[model samples]
Target: MNRVILIGHLARDPEMRYTPNGTAVTTFTLAVNRPKTKEGVEQQPDWINCVVWQKTAENCANFLRKGSKALVEGRIQTRSFDDKEGNKRYVTEVVGENVHFLSPKNQGNLFDEPFSPRPPVNINDDDLPF
Candidate 1:
């Protein structure tokens, strides 16, 4: 029962890499905004690290860019490794199960199309069937 769902924007473009066994892997950071406190204090955004594997990883790397909105569904995992200074470091990341792109294809053109005035119809009130 360990699952997590996050909706956020990409902090940077997804980085794609391959494992020794040639498995495609992609990594990215999601910038999720935190809810304000009861005292109305602004909270800093949470940068969550996410990882995708195989075809999904390839798709994310190919389509996702910085500032692209996405919905990530995954599980949390923690791993430990030794740093350069010989100190053990622990890192947490989400292993993505599904990644949904939320941004429109042409975001910049979203508001570029101005509203147009409609033309008047030639129908008369006397022709109404009601």
Candidate 2:
């Protein structure tokens, strides 16, 4: 019941860092456009903060970039900490369980070649049952 799924473009490139214990973590902001309720109404974009850990965090940092589209499935987490000013600051972010890269493999800057469409395979007449 705490699950959340979001498909959106990266607001910026993912930032990777290591914890004090040397655990890898990555953070990124996703910009999802909301649906318009009426004709002529413009959709607003929601900026969601997302986090990934370990190998997933490394992959996200390596493959994803600004404007890259992805589907993130995760759970919401909120935590609070005291700032240097002694004020309590709270943050809410999605802790990603899985992130599906939605952009074409070739379209990513990580890849060298551009995407080329493959020709359709011809079906044999004997293969059809109907």
lDDT of each structure?
Answer: 0.91, 0.92
For model 1, the local distance difference test gives 0.91
Q: Which residue runs of candidate 2 sit more than 4 Å off their true CA positions?
A: 109-130
Angstrom error of the Cα, residue 36, model 2: value is 1.6
Q: What is the model-wide C-alpha lDDT for candidate 2?
A: 0.92
Model 1, residue 96: displacement in angstroms? 0.5
Cα error of candidate 2 at position 49, Å = 0.3
True-vs-predicted CA distance for residue 76, candidate 1, Å? 0.2
Q: Report the lDDT tens digits of candidate 1 across residue range 1-130.
A: 9999999999998999999999999999999999999999989999999999999999998888899889999999999999999999999999999998887766421222245554788998999998
The TM-scores, one per candidate, come to 0.78, 0.81
TM-score of 1: 0.78
C-alpha lDDT of residue 42 in model 1: 80
